[model samples]
Target: MTGGAVRPEGPRASERAARPDGALMIEARSISYAYKETVALRDVSFGLPKGETLAVVGPSGCGKTTLLSLIAGLMPSTAGQLRVDGAPVQPRRPGTALILQDYGLLPWKTVRENVALGLRIRGMKPDAADQALREVGIADLAGRWPHQLSGGQKQRVAIARSLALGPDLLLMDEPFSALDALTREEMQDLLLSIWRRHRTSLVLVTHSITEAVYLGQQIMVLSPRPGQVVGLFRNPTVGDRRAAAFHEMVNRVRDALEKGVNGGA
Candidate 1:
């Protein structure tokens, strides 16, 4: 269930050593997507280094989820290039996992079954799935159905489902937006802890300013409607979410968002 080994001659392996400790996990260049006559994204470009977290923030209907879908290999770009683990992403790429806002669990499935779904799809046993549930602190509730779980518990199941696959890259679409404040904070802490332990590359799409600054090592700001990369802010306090430095970074991201939404390039 690992991301597998990287061959010396493989796409990113040639200069993997020279490229910094964590090489690029995802690279998008001049990417664009359209739904019929409406353009969703345009000229969006960014590179996420391995083991880092990237947060994408933008106004509503700005194609944030669309970008995540593209990276997750759910769909292809209408124009430009998208690569995951240095290879062109295609449908169901093993190195990527996506956690949607709705949890995406089958209502009739028990918690354990839901978590085991992805692993089963990859032809792996349910061992990793059980391990994932334990990691998320829900091993005791594995038999509970989705209807029997609270919002936070359901989200944990979603996270565990993704983690069970051991994906090198995890794509999350506002996974905490629906939780209550206290629950959301708890989930955020859980995510940070899991991220520190797993060191998996993460890209989260969120509209919350505070959440973006707290979780993202790099915050990418996008414009309205026809989304584009208006700015990309690198956070200095990667794990110090409550520090003064973290607040400063948040202000910087907020300013960038304002400028970008106000028509800055």
Candidate 2:
């Protein structure tokens, strides 16, 4: 599932290192969403600093995915504002990219072709598309179909495709939830490595507190249905996932989620 290569535009520097002063990249001001009679989000507001990873965690049906959709412009908000780089986000924009839980690779296409699909859709040449595959380290599996690759391989391809676009903002929706423990860890490490190479602001939604702590410089815990941000924690000493401080932050987030589910916090 490798993505095709793009000409690599936008800001330079590794994604995490690029935000020296921590300027805002994505902003949600009093954002709310509803479906028919059901309220999905309620006055959820947060700011994602450029080149930083912000992980959203909450119980099932907490509108985590809906929030991502709003940020990605997959759907319109019923109220409030959603912005990217200070401007309203538009779906399929060059400045942002999305990676779904399912990988979303076309079964009929080979790994290379699937990776290149985005660029091809954007009207890029074949040569440039091939280069994107190489950037994601799936060049060897370029000709293989999605069914032929392992779960981790498929995820790598999905990520490669996203990176090939050189997006300033990257949205991920429980991307590793479907994989086994070992594979999920591998994917996490791979993602950190890639983020180091390309400095994209990341907004990842997940149920795992541990996963959130491992990847995010900042973590936001949302309450149950009609989601609202209940708690926020920042880890200044990121990258040391095993540190006591990191574990403490993880426990705090987990407690917040449990409290939110039980209507305590």
Candidate 3:
């Protein structure tokens, strides 16, 4: 896939992957948020090492998605320090991409156009879009309109768009929630493959416990509204769902989630 991805060529991807030289990729300290009177998140602190994946899981309205926005620099935190790549968060920082739950595609754009959109904005060769589409196994669907694709196909286009931009920090807010079970599994496997190859820092917010355990090397659980960090689990065996202890980790996360609901309420 020789194309217009930034970060330069040659030894860069290795340098990026080797960036875990004792520095965190993401750091949040005493992060809090409120909408005038309605508090959403409170004192949430966490650190994500470079090239690792984190999954945030909690009940609805726990500010899980809001946390992603904060990390993406979409909005400032109400209080505390938040940094990414050792710098203060900035809106739409280069090499940082957010994938929304709703697919976020322009209805009028073909799959190819949608994939090329972010690249063009970044001054990259939009022609490289085809390579991204092929990466996600959707190059054949490039000419099709969004409405013509199935839910899973639409999600593929969305993933291709972000991959096209060659993001270093990938934040996904329930990217697979809209898909059926089989398709969701397929997409999950595809994402694991991509992560293995690219080694990007990933943060995913989802409601599914199984999904969290499957993908997150680090799993964070937030409490209900006025969210707080209630639990954080380390899953060394991430991506191996058939492992003997995989279900055990899921149960632990489930228990922590219930604790959040009961104590938070």
Candidate 4:
């Protein structure tokens, strides 16, 4: 917890958690995609409830990132419909935020500048961005550049940048893949803390079973190449990552992934 203790009460509770009636925040049906002739995803379908997380785990080149990109509106699908917050997903929707493993920060910009970049692009003031720096516990380093920061700090800046937008859905593609083990674990806790506070729907694309089980409320396992959903499991250790149930679920996901990869499901 490099950042100060995560504030449990952030903004509004309702905004953080979607209604308890199980309202759907994202719906994807029979979605398929291809790069010209090479297929990336095929007939993939899943629904994500508001304020919950859906962690996608699959073999390499299994279309995990492709599926995320489809949901984020970074690219269009070849078939099927996707709706987020009850509306069709469009390119670069203001209500959605996407973070990648590369950190995606402009090297020229300072930490504060990077965090405030999104708000500035949206023609919003820097007040929220300033608050975001405080939230991520990098207020003193706001003047620092990306090269001057550690991997964890850079990731925090990236997270802060995304939070500055106040997104309804936060999408991450192996965002902590490059961090060291200890830093990665810390970042995971930091992410969960923020998610608990904001209640914003999150979709994480990761290769680590431990990560998927520890952070995901629901886990989606896709088959290798031309990926399709092979399994979906409801994780029981949402609030308690130290529980036996969490490790059990990790093994389960690993087993499912093995089966998916070996059986070519």
Candidate 4 structure, TM-score to reference: 0.91
Off by over 4 Å in 3: 1-19
Model 2 regions lying over 4 Å from their true place: 1-17, 20-22
> How do the residues 62-165 of candidate 1 rate in per-residue lDDT, one tens digit apiece?
99999999998888999998888889988988878989999999998999999999878878898898899999999999999999999999999999999999
Candidate 4 per-residue C-alpha lDDT over 21-70 given as tens digits, one digit per residue, 9 for 90 to 100:
56777888888999999999988878787878878899889999888899
In every candidate, how many clashes are there?
0, 8, 0, 2
Estimate, for each residue in 93-205, the C-alpha lDDT of model 2 and write its tens digit: 78789999999999999988888788888887656556667766778999999999999899989988877676888999999998999999888888877776676788899
lDDT of 1: 0.84
Cα lDDT of candidate 3 equals: 0.86
State every prediction's TM-score relative to the real structure.
0.90, 0.90, 0.91, 0.91
Q: Candidate 2: what lDDT?
A: 0.80
Model 1: how far residue 16 lies from native, Å: 16
Roughly what TM-score does model 1 have, to 2 decimal places? 0.90
Question: Which pairs clash in the backbone of model 1?
Answer: none
Please identify model 1 stretches exceeding 4 Å from their true place: 1-22
